[model samples]
Target: MSTVHIKPVPVTPEEVIAVARDHARVVIDAEAREAMAASRAIVDAIEREGRPVYGVSTGFGALANTFVEPERRAELQHALIRSHAAGVGDPMPEEVVRAMMLLRVRSLAMGRSGVRPEIAEGLAALLNADITPWVPRHGSLGASGDLAPLAHCAMVLLGEGWVREADGSRVDAGPVLERAGLRPITLSSKEGLALINGTDGMLGMLILAVADLRHLLTMADVCAALSNEAMLGSDRPFQPELHEIRPQPGQAKSAANIHKLLQDSEVMDSHRNDLAHAVQDAYSMRCAPQVAGAARDVLAYAETVADQELRSVVDNPVVLPDGRVESTGNFHGAPLGYAADFLGIAATDVGSISERRVDRLLDITRNRGLPAFLSPDPGVNSGLMIAQYTAAGIVAENRRLSAPASVDSVPTSGMQEDHVSMGWAAACKLRTIIDNLGTLLAVEMLAATQGLQLRLPLIPSPAARAATAAVGPIAGKPGPDQFLAPVIEQVKRLIESPALRHEIEEAAGPLA
Candidate 1:
């Protein structure tokens, strides 16, 4: 198995993606172990002194004032895990659970959580052994550090929950741990709290979402360029000189990408001297850079936030080297919530614009001289007309999903936690929006490629030709309209395929 070294420092989203999606083995750094041991000494000392140190000795949230005796401290930790592992609904994808576990291990390795090094190592062992705990999709409020969801993950370490086996069946984790030469960890002072009290769940989703959006956004540019070429749109608006006056970095990059994709096109050349063509194109074609570029900029800001969160130790009652355990609100999910909400809005707009381009391709009156719906035989076959409807339905749903969940706060835990970030909700909805965007872009690719092929003798640019060829194998050529649902799925896979993107880039260089 390939391995990833986890240290007491921030890791990039790419690293998180590798572990979460690619099943990389994890090994904690020696320095991180030393740091964890040092912090554990402080927690042990506090336990010996019999001083109530929040999570170390006392009950949590509304019960913080209730102190437990040292003899029952271990029970407190176990009870905390059992109670907080109250997540409901279907289990989250194994990849998402692995990400949450990895992030929790990374935060604990920072040594500020006062967890024993064994606790961190146990989490790493689970990842290395490919033992994914059954974490439910709903539970976290995005405040109090994704407590419920993380607790479900922590339950597996204590040999108390279900784990996914190699064959994808859920089985008892205790047997799995024993078979892997791992023993269930015994919780010590603050160890259970350390395991569960962090922003690992939301942060994990945010990091993964960022990685997905990065690829999809770049692919969006490629799809837009193809649509623009098929629609016979002018490239004059994408000139570098025209973009420099406005000077949005993402905008300039997006326009440059479109300009490069349209370079040396026979289709474009065919219309270069045609004065009868409209001087400009519709907003969807002409403003592709402006809209997609704005999304690129939003993603950059979100990446910055994810980077900062990666470095943070977001636990309550964080241990310090000077022996002070201070309770702070560092675990609040507001920052991540705002970023997720903004990204959803951006994704919705990107999908919305792509739907517009798909719409233009289907309308006989609006599609220049192309046949109705890009069908080889109009009226007799619906062609891509319903595909446009599907895309529009998803686009409409995205607009509803893009409503910011962060703005609303609900009180919980006897109102001790009066305000919650709801960042988890935002992150979940953003994921849906990103998926819907891919489908929407796929519809545009299907229609645009068909429209370009219908243009015939006048071939598209090298980049467009490459993109069309990449998707052709999956979507096939436009003919008597067969069942399109399967074809749309195939095209969506192509849109998300890195190999297809690479093929296009080989012809047009890198996109924005």
Candidate 2:
């Protein structure tokens, strides 16, 4: 058999998402090796000189000043894992655990965490073999870099606890590795510290969120196009020149996207002539470009933070090139935490406005002569009425979740761990909010498409028409109570697909 040597691979945030969603293997490269060596040298010097490093040579957390004997350092490391693996509640879903593994591997590949090369190799190997440690969902303050959750991850390397195998079986980490023909790495000086001391958990969730956010933003544009067509609203709000005068990047881009999606429609110019109905539509329909545009702006800022974080080494006691080891708060999750909280609020608003559009479509008075709830049978069918309620419920929940987690702080590790960022909470809530938004938008897509069809035989804007066609088969407007969960999942698949998004955009005409 030919040998295929696996080398260390460079990772980007997008690659992390891909690996999380689709079980992809990971490898390390030559460049990563060099960086690892540099970090190891600094850590080794500190160890040999008997200098007290926060996590490497002393007790962790509030007990940082408590020193340990040299011989017991390994035991100390193991103890840290056992004690910090205090996560409670339901275990995280497989995809999230996979995301954590991918993020941790990429962080080590950056080669600044002072972990042994073999440690990184073993972690990557587990991922390659699809051995994901079963970590709990709830128990991180998001300060000091997701310490509790990551400790569970590190414990699996010690062959001490249970993990999920490729086939989704929960088994002991030791036997799982044995069956997979992979050996666990030994805990050494700063190795355990390196593994558990970072913002990988929060960052992993953020990577997934940002990717989904991009999709939702695109879906927002598509939904707006459909609403515009259904309402037969004037397209003047999307004029490029109108946004140019205001000069907001997101506004300009969003308006351009709307203009492009509606460009080829014969119905648009026909409706532009002083409408007998009123001057312009409500803010939800006419100001779709502006409101959705703001979300794009916050998402851009969140992306920058995530990209830089992927390349960063966010552990305590960083090692420098000149063989100097310094204890610092690099593992602090404030930056990512605050950004995630902001993104939660912004994305929550997206769903909030989407529900409003759903309300308009369902209301008999405001729906421009469409049947109540878009039902052909009206009171007999109650078509899409409860779906609007579901949408409203999710949006209300999002509002509650939108309250910033970053603003709250609780002291842990005694007073030493004072001023926590609650970053993990922010990331977790953001993930929930985004998922809810996806379902809400999916429902909106179904509702708006039905409204468009009722006004049928009247051609819609090219972009809206194409999106409707793409989602038609996935989430068709069925009669009452047709098991919407499956249909919601189908629409989610469409939302996640970049190819479908591009196709819809292409049909809309060139992006303005």
Q: Which candidate has the highest lDDT of all? A: 1
TM-score of each: 0.98, 0.93
> Which of the numbered candidates is closest to the native, going by highest TM-score?
1
lDDT of 2 by residue, 1-512 (tens): 11112233435765776677776656577777777877887777778899888777898888888999889988888888888888887677677777776677667766667877777777777777877787887778887788888888887888877796556566778888788887766787787877888888888888889888887887887787777767677677888889989988887877887777776665566567754866878888888888889999999999999888876777777776666667778788999999999999999988888889989988998888788888878877888888888888899999999999998998977788889889998999999999888888888888888887777667777776777787778756545546666876787677667776778756755442
Q: Point out where model 2 deviates above 4 Å.
A: 1-10, 166-169, 474-485, 510-512
Task: Rate residue 91 of model 1 by lDDT.
Answer: 76
Ten-residue stretch with the least lDDT total in model 2: 1-10
* Candidate 2 to native Cα RMSD, angstroms: 2.9
Task: Report lDDT (CA) for all predictions.
Answer: 0.88, 0.79
Q: How many pairs in model 2 have backbone atoms within 3 A of each other, for residues 3 or more apart or on separate chains, i.e. clashes?
A: 5
Please list the residue runs of candidate 1 whose C-alpha ends up more than 4 Å from where it truly belongs after superposition: 166-168
